[model samples]
Target: MSLTFDGTVLVPVADPDDGERTAAALAPYLSPSSTVLVVNVIEKAGGAPDKASVEQREEYAREIFERARGPLAERAGSVETAVLFGTDVVETIFEAAVDRNADAVVFEPREGRRFVELLTGDVARRLVKEARVPVVALPEDDG
Candidate 1:
């Protein structure tokens, strides 16, 4: 199918390295007129004690955005970042897409072994299966 980047795109990243890699993968599809929304979800423990302070998590999210900003800025008209909080990562990503009025949810799938993916609930699989908006999984950049 043909993918257009004339509208806003929501990209959910796992960490700093993933942010950079995903940015590279997505850059080719974007234009100077496209708006890119980069997000990192900080998983909350539902009502239990949190793994880290909110401040710490927000700071890490900033790092993830920083890693991605340069590459995306080179191609997109604008690059924006958000730190989302939710018990469910996939759900939060979808919610952000809808809330931001994103044209599509685009990402570079994270790498993991089958066992690890199963144990971790396989977020990439769920993202493709559960997204309400169009989702694009771009191939990793060779460089």
Candidate 2:
């Protein structure tokens, strides 16, 4: 029997593997009722001398989301992307998912753009900690 999934899926993606793996895990389970919502949060205040202010952070997030559309869609079918400002990645994901009435969250277990710098602790875990909705976390194969 097929799982009766309703509403959108919240995918907190930072890289291609996150997108791809989320797609892979979701492929077998997803039905026509499923939709993917990708939330890419680019941290605003870096240790850099020039830290992004509130507006700048939001703008940067928007830009990142815009640039990522084609790539994400290629992996997970149609997706709605959003860039949000704040250090609380957990809160951001929770708010976005709940706001959109997402049935669950499918995500990758990594962060950052490069191989070595990726943060091992994923935002999805935080979602699991904070939100009651189901969160599916996928790790990319080393191969």
Candidate 3:
């Protein structure tokens, strides 16, 4: 069956470059009526000190959104951005999908070494395995 991109889609980006690539990959599937909700999760330390200040992280999230919005706007009816705070990145994305009543969760997996992915509990794997809503991993945009 073909997937429909007529409703709201929740997209999680790891950084500015990820945002740009994801938007490019996802754009082809979206129609002019689709709504893309792009989000960046600020991974909290769960009681310990955070890595970056909240302000800095928020600014970074804005940068990610800005990079993603242009491409998404060309295909989607509207593009919206959110900064999410959570100890578990995948869980935060799932929660956002439920909260937003999203039709699906879309993303382009970030590149990482095998050891690093193993150590960090590979978010892309977890997102697909434990998804609350449908999760679509768009292929990387070579163009």
Task: Write model 1 residue lDDT over 7-75, tens digit each, in one string.
Answer: 999999999999999998888889888999999999999999998999999999999999999788778
Query: lDDT, candidate 3, residue 138?
Result: 86
| Error of model 1, residue 55, in angstroms | 0.6
- Residue-level lDDT tens digits of model 2 in 1-143: 45533567887766544445555555555555557777776554445553656677566556555654544444444567777545567777777778788888776565455544346344544666777677766546464
lDDT of 3: 0.92
lDDT tens digits, residue span 23-129, model 3: 98898889888999999999999999998999999999999999998888778998999999999999999999999999999988888999999999999999999
Score every model by TM-score: 0.95, 0.61, 0.95
Off by over 4 Å in 2: 1-4, 46-78, 111-122, 138-143
Q: Model 2 clash pairs?
A: none
Tell me the spans in candidate 3 whose CA falls farther than 4 Å from its real position: 1-4
